[model samples]
Structure formats: structure tokens, C-alpha cells
Target: MYYHWIDTEKPAWAVTEIRERSRRAWNSLFAEERREKAEAEEKAEQERELKEYYAEQHRFFEEMGKKNREEARRMEEQERQRKEAREAERQRKKERARQAKATEEAGDGKGKYPRWTQ
Candidate 1:
């Protein structure tokens, strides 16, 4: 079947050429739209992956900070206990020295020689 333009008596070859051009233009436009859509989807997927990565990193750092704080508290407790033990040891030594001095004084002015010897 021969297609003819109703308004203009164009040659058959010109009509075929025009139809081919129009079809090609439409195909090009649709192709560009598809490419743009694919690119946008890819960009959104990349952004989602980046967000998940950052969230994981944040969680890791938070856990590390918690561990560090716990360690610091443990160390502080250990130091406090050590200080208390040292203080107790010092008090015991002082008490022993005071008792020894009192005993020596009680032995007579001969300085702990025995009561019989004095």
C-alpha cells in the first residue's frame, strides 16, 4: 500500500524519509530517558550503601568508646584500692613502731636489757 500525505502531494520517497526520521527521533528520546532513569537509580543505590557504611562505622566507634570508658573506670578503681592498701600498710607500720618505742621505754633506762640484768 502506498501512503500519501493528505495536505501536500509529496513524493512517496519524501514521505518515507520523513516517517523514518520521526521514528528515529522518538527512539532517541526514549533511549535518553531510559539512560537517565538508570543513572538516577544507580546514584540512589550508591547513596544508600554509603549511608549504611557510615552507620556501621558510627556503631563501631560508639562500642569502642564504651569499652574505653569501662577500662578507664576499672583502672581508676584499681588505683583507688591500691591507695587504700598502701594507707593501711603505713598505719600498721606506724602502730608497730609506736608499740616498740613504748615497750622499750617500759624496759628501764638501760634500753631493753632485761629486768634481772638491770
Candidate 2:
């Protein structure tokens, strides 16, 4: 027995013509018995690959997050050091000014250089 399937490439043939070929595309690739098995296997393989890929991305993202956190911490420490250095510079300048004022006052004292009484 043979069945007629809509095959534009092959056109319509007699029942005997279809049977003589021995292999009907519909029977081999589209039969209810075999179709589900092939489709299910292909679907399962694709789904497994997709799941593995997502897992890989998650791991990669976790690693990146750790690296980013470490980088942020390092940058924060550097900024703190820079602020401390700036504060030390200001303190040194203030000390230098105070020393200059004291030296001027001391030099103005004595018989040769006496302080003016006001």
C-alpha cells in the first residue's frame, strides 16, 4: 500500500510509483512512531547544551564580580593614601610659616635690633 503526500519537488505519482521507491519520506521521517523520538532527542540535546552554556556564563559572571570588588577596594585604598599625603603637605606648610615668624621675632630682640615699644 502507498500514501499520497504533498511533495512539490516530486509532483504527484501513482500508488505503484510511490510503493516501488520502497522508502516514503513521510513514513521514514514523519511517521508517528519515529517522529517523536527523533524530535525529542534533538530537543533534549539542544536543551542540555543551552543549560550548560548558561551555567558557564553564571560562573564567569561570578568571577568577574569578585575581581571587580577587589579592584574597587584597591582603588579606595589608594584614594585614602592620596588624601593623607595632601593633609601632610598642608601641615608641613603651616609649620614652616610658624617657624619663619618665630625667627623674625627673635632677630628683632637685642641691643643692635630692639623691638619697638607701642
Candidate 3:
């Protein structure tokens, strides 16, 4: 039987065209939505990777800071030890001068003042 346009039915040819066009439009819309979703997922993944990278960098700096502080403390201790050693040497020299002065006073008349006539 030949297909015909009827009062209650669409023509076969027109129905086919309408169905094909509707399917194409629906497929294109679906493709666009899929592309948008993929792009969004990629952006979220990039942001997560960036956050992890920054956290690692911050940890590295924190470790460096700890090492620097330890080095500075060691240097300060060395400087303090050197200063104490110098102070001890100065005190020893002062003690020797005092002993020499006492000895000279006890030697009294053994030698006259070089600039005077006794």
C-alpha cells in the first residue's frame, strides 16, 4: 500500500524528515553538553594539581627555614665560646701584671730610681 497524508496521521516523507532533523538537533545538543562537562572536569583537576604543588613548595621552604635556624644557632654558640675564651685570656694577663707589681714593691732599695740621685 502507498503511504498517504491522512487527517489523523503525518505524511510519511514529512515525518521522516522531521524525525531526522530532531535527532540531529538532539545529538548536537548532547555533544555540546558533554564537551562542557569534560572541560569543567579538566579545570577542576588542574586546580587540584596546582594546590598540591603549592603545598609541596611550602613544605620545602619550611624545611629550609628549620635548617637555617639550626645553622644560625650553631654559629651563635661558636661566637659565644670564642668571646668567653678571649675574656679568660684577658683576666689571666691582668693577674700576671698584679703579681709583677707586688714583687717590684718588695725589691725596694735594691735598685734606685733611674732618674734620681740617692
RMSD of each: 5.4, 10.8, 6.0
Please write out the lDDT profile of model 3 over residues 73-111, one tens digit for every residue: 999999999999999999999998887677666645555
Q: Which stretches of candidate 1 lie over 4 Å from their true place?
A: 1-10, 108-118
Model 2, 1-118: lDDT tens digits are 9988777475457656887666675566568767788899999999999999999999999999999999999999999999999999999999988887777676656666545432
TM-scores of all candidate predictions against the true structure: 0.77, 0.61, 0.70
* lDDT head-to-head 2 vs 3, winner: 3
Off by over 4 Å in 2: 1-31, 109-118
Clashing pairs in 3: none
Better of 1 and 2 by TM-score: 1
Clashing pairs in 2: none
Candidate 3 structure lDDT: 0.89
Q: Tens digit of lDDT per residue, candidate 1, span 10-108?
A: 889999999999999999999999999999999999999999999999999999999999999999999999999999999999999888777767866
Q: How far in Å is the alpha carbon of 27 misplaced in model 2?
A: 7.0
Task: Report lDDT (CA) for all predictions.
Answer: 0.92, 0.83, 0.89
**What is the alpha-carbon lDDT for the whole of candidate 1?**
0.92
Runs of candidate 3 exceeding 4 Å displacement: 1-5, 8-13, 107-118
